[model samples]
Target: MSTLTFRSVSLRYPPRAARAGVGEKLVLDGIDLQVASHELVAIIGRSGSGKTSLLNLAAGFLEPTAGTITVDGVPIEGPSADRAVVFQDDALYPWLDARDNIALPFKLKGVPLAERRARAEQLLARVGLADAGDRRIWELSGGMRQRVGIARALAAEPRFLLLDEPLGALDALTRTRMQEFLLRIKAESGAGALLITHSIEEALLLGTRIVVLSPNPGRLTAEIEAGFNAEVLNGASVAAVKASPIFKRMHAGLTGLIHASAEEEIAA
Candidate 1:
């Protein structure tokens, strides 16, 4: 069962300003979300909307102030091998080459060098970096580094993949290619993916469901069903599908929701 559930989860940060004389700063409130096997849930919002916070909570990097998150009914106490995270910075070891970086997790697990190398090679090919495996971290481009990061995450063989703006740092063309790569990887891995992104188009294209959050103590503002991800997985032309009427409709509606939420924040 590829199930991840967050029930009424909330996060609050202690007041940092001296003499501010305020209560805790709430970042997330009453969040209820679920991701199932073969599902991609995209989280989108403006800056400071706690998009990354939700991902961090899921990764066990931070504990919520209240509520619970479970994986297949088991409470999440800390990071586990069954869950892997890909950050926006492509957090690879600077000293390691691409192949070694991808295999690092395996090596830590006591996997023989040969077996880890073989698996890393396969993952490299999967991410379109077949020939770049020998390149050191510094030798690759930003997009290439992120590709290696993805390969490394897959090395862990995680059942759930948590991504925080995984493609946000790439150039437009590279980002587009990586989106396709992401879709293919998700299909092949059959893992539940929760991606936090700023680009609404990216969210709509990559997610079977899109969850929008409001600013300042982020809360779920809207939940949209976007099946274009399924279409892309089924070999449908992504560009053509994006241009379809339903896509346009949902995009317009979501944009409106985001704007309304922003306006609400301003008015408050």
Candidate 2:
């Protein structure tokens, strides 16, 4: 199994030229995180807690000011097919249909057209978009577009998925449905997932492990093991698992924890 590791990672940004005399701002500090091929780790925090920064670091869009990020012990040099990212905007190419969008990755690698088309078809089916391959990006629903985006990511055969609030833009009912879809897709893809979400419930429901960060130079403040995802994956319905007493208790506790952290930050 592959593992993505972040050790004592920190990120800081210098003040913009327009902000004269302002000191550099620290975004993340001393972060240590890991995600294995078999795990989905959800990270939660309030605004300015560096949640997106952390994901960006893992994606190699930005290097840490200090510390290292590695996959299977080798430092990440830059973005690679080893880690695929999904954004909230469902970043699909409108000019192309879903199939061609997914096939674009293969085309870049110079794969034969027929082979790429076949692989793209397989991925569309995998994401439950079997008949939507020819659908235009603008013609699909928000959820459908997101599925296509995910299918495109999987076409890269990445060892890890870096999700930056991929479902945050969907409507409530759609978001709920997509949550389950994410669980199933993550399992089927066999790629470790690092999800950044603002919803404590989302983190609890989907994460094998939930990590909380405290703001003002974000730091890891809490890590909780969650079994709700496993229960749902093991045949318990999402509604049933969510309605259970344990699930309710954990959700409430996580809510309190995040609120308390924010309060503390404000008081400081």
Candidate 3:
């Protein structure tokens, strides 16, 4: 199995000239994390906790100020097809239909037209959008659009998925359904995932391991092992798994942990 590792990683942005006498702002500090193939690691924390920063580092969109990030021991230099990212906004091209959008990655790689088209069709089916391949991006619902985005990401055949609040934009009912869909896709695709979310319930429901980051220079503060995702994959209903006592307890504990961190930050 492949492993994505962040070793003592930290990020600091230079102080703006306008902020006279202010030192550099530290965003993340001493972060050590690993996401292995087929494992979903969910990251949860309050705003300003650098959850998105962590995801960006993994995506190679931003470099850390210290330490290193690697996939199977090779240092990451910049964004590559090996790590696919799905954002809250679908980011689909309005000019292209769903199928063509998914095929865009392959097209970039110089894959022939016929091959890319065939592969795009397969991904459409995988994401349960088999008949929506011809649909216009503007015509699809928010959930449908996100599915297309995910399919496009999978087109890269990446080793890891960096999901940045992919479901945060959806309505309550759709978000609930998408949670189950995500678990299924994670299992079927066999790609490790690093999900940055604000929802404690989401972290508990989907994560094989939930990691918490404390703010004001985000640091890994807690890690909790969870099996709810595996339970769903094993044929248990999402509702059933969520309603269990252990699930509720963990959710409460995580909520308290995050709230306490926020309170402590305020008191300081």
Candidate 4:
């Protein structure tokens, strides 16, 4: 059971002398968050809310100015296989085919070709790309490439999955289907996920817990126990859960919460 925890973590860009005369920039402050293997936490807030900053910190791309971040009780000093990130931009190698991209991490660890191929094939199928394993990255569509990116992340078998608006580029219908796909993946892998998204409905649909952050120097403004997928876990259809009254209520409430946060930001 892997867990990621942040204890009063704060991140800031040290005072810069008059680039725009803005001076110091505090991106995030006093963030305390935890994600267990059994839970997926979704963070939503307005643009410039430092949502991506929080994910970058967790991914070990940046160090916190204060407090600490730990994965499975150990300090995260740099990027490790324990945390896998999927950015909005698909970062697949253009020279490689889908299967090769997914198997890259295993290859880095010196796994034999036969084993890596089998593992990559399994992950491709898990991401709904079973037949597209050999297709070159250039041959895939934007959404398909994104799926391969996710498949690559899955192949790492990371304890924590960090997603930054991974589906923000998809059409509405495709986004919905991908949401279902993500839920299935989470069910199967039980890996803790931290998804930073701009969509309230998306967060409500997939997150076990939804967190809202305030703007500028982001801070946790609200946390909601979504549990919207609870019924889905009991064999209820995704469509049924999406159309349920509870989902509608929570959707409206979250929409309001976002608006309230935006107003607060403007007023501050």
Candidate 5:
């Protein structure tokens, strides 16, 4: 089932006092989270809340300073193909076209050139970039680049997908479109995802469960079940959701919580 487990996890960045005159930073404080198979969980927090660090740990891009993390009952020591990450920057090679970018993973895995090309073409179509396969990254828009990134990530058929603010840089309209596209891709691929984002609207629209992290020594503050319907998320129903009494209440609560935490940090 590819379950992910985090047992009393913590992360500390060593003191850079010689340069910054600050003490060692405690980034994550004893976090314990589990993401079950096929679950799409969103982690939301203000800037500098260590949300990215947490995602890095899950992806094995960074080891936890303490405790253990396991994927599918296997201890994670480093990066592996079983987990794929889609970052905020898209990170596509400027020189490579969409097809070549998507084919990089297969090329690295030593898949035959013809097979890689075929798979890349298929994934580009899947990600709505079928006509963009031959277009270089520079020729594509920001949202299109990210679509290519998503296609590249899918090339591995990863069991776990980690997204770090993958749509944060896009324009509002484009972000909304990408959100619906992501939902469709998730449904089609059936890959479990852990998304780190700051947008409450995005979380509410996309997450199966939303986990909010408190600021400074970031840790889980609240976990809310998100029962967003695919149809509602993809249609004009978003306006209705925003107008719903429950939505207004929760949005106010979360926004207040975020600001209150920031104020507390300032006061401290």
Candidate 6:
């Protein structure tokens, strides 16, 4: 059964001078969504389309101005350990090294120091930063820092993961590598994930279900299943997917929808 649900969800930014005469800008409007247990769903939209806001809502960082959001049959009130969020910025503590940063959550929860250290070491290794565990945030590469952030999130062992453009800052090569890492991690972890991203290619490559949102007062514009099987990772057949009719169609359709929506906003 699906563990997350949002019904008639809407969010409004507080009225500012720019929007005061018109109205409070509605960021999200009537978002009705459900993410089943162990399902990886990607939400795609242009900037200001409320993709990050949606993740924030799910993470319980922000409460919806309207409607209900529930996780594990419980209505979400505020941030909880049950849901872990990895933001666009790699928010690792600068002073703490990767291992300590990953262990922070466990430490906060009063887990034994030995246990926290062992789990942190395991997660850092899992994320391919085993030898770099003692490296400070500033010392590591951008991709390595991002991996540390991911490891920290996983250390909590949350039921649901909310990712807000976690790979947005990486270079193209790094982004592709991170994408594969994320796919592999998801496959192995079986943790439900809701990823908010602007990249159509990323969405297509990563999502089981891709959701498109229309900008002004963000509403779901379309939902499409990205028909990628688990084998895509293990098999070394990139050319096949590029040549695939279904993949091409999805790429074109999602790209077109995003552009069209942006154009509509401009014309309005």
lDDT of 2 by residue, 66-118 (tens): 99999999999999988999988988999999999999889988999999999
Colliding pairs, model 6: none
Which TM-score value belongs to model 6? 0.92
Error of 3 at 209 (Å): 0.2
> With candidate 3 superimposed using the best TM-score fit, by how many Å does residue 170's alpha carbon deviate from the native?
0.4
TM-score per candidate, chains pooled: 0.95, 0.96, 0.96, 0.94, 0.92, 0.92
lDDT, model 5, position 234: 57
Model 2 RMSD in angstroms: 1.6
lDDT of each: 0.90, 0.93, 0.93, 0.88, 0.85, 0.85
Candidate 5 per-residue lDDT over residues 4-33, each given as its tens digit: 888898887762446553677888888888
Residue lDDT tens for model 1, 1-268:
5799999999887525354536668899999999997789999999989999899999998888889999999999888877899989998998889999999989989999999999999999998899998998999998899889988998999989999999999999889878888999988898899999999989999998999999898999999888898888788877788799988888888889999999999999
Candidate 3 displacement at residue 131 in angstroms: 1.0
Q: Tell me the tens digit of each residue's lDDT in model 3 across 128-156.
A: 99999899999999999999999999999
- Scored by Cα lDDT, where does model 1 land? 0.90
Model 2, poorest ten-residue lDDT window?
Answer: 13-22
Per-model root-mean-square deviation over C-alphas = 1.9, 1.6, 1.6, 2.0, 2.5, 2.3
How far in Å is the alpha carbon of 262 misplaced in model 1? 0.8
| lDDT score of residue 2 within candidate 3 | 92
The predicted structure with the larger lDDT, 2 or 5, is: 2
Residues 25-96 of candidate 4: C-alpha lDDT, one tens digit per residue: 889999999999988899999888899999999999989988899987889989887899988988899899
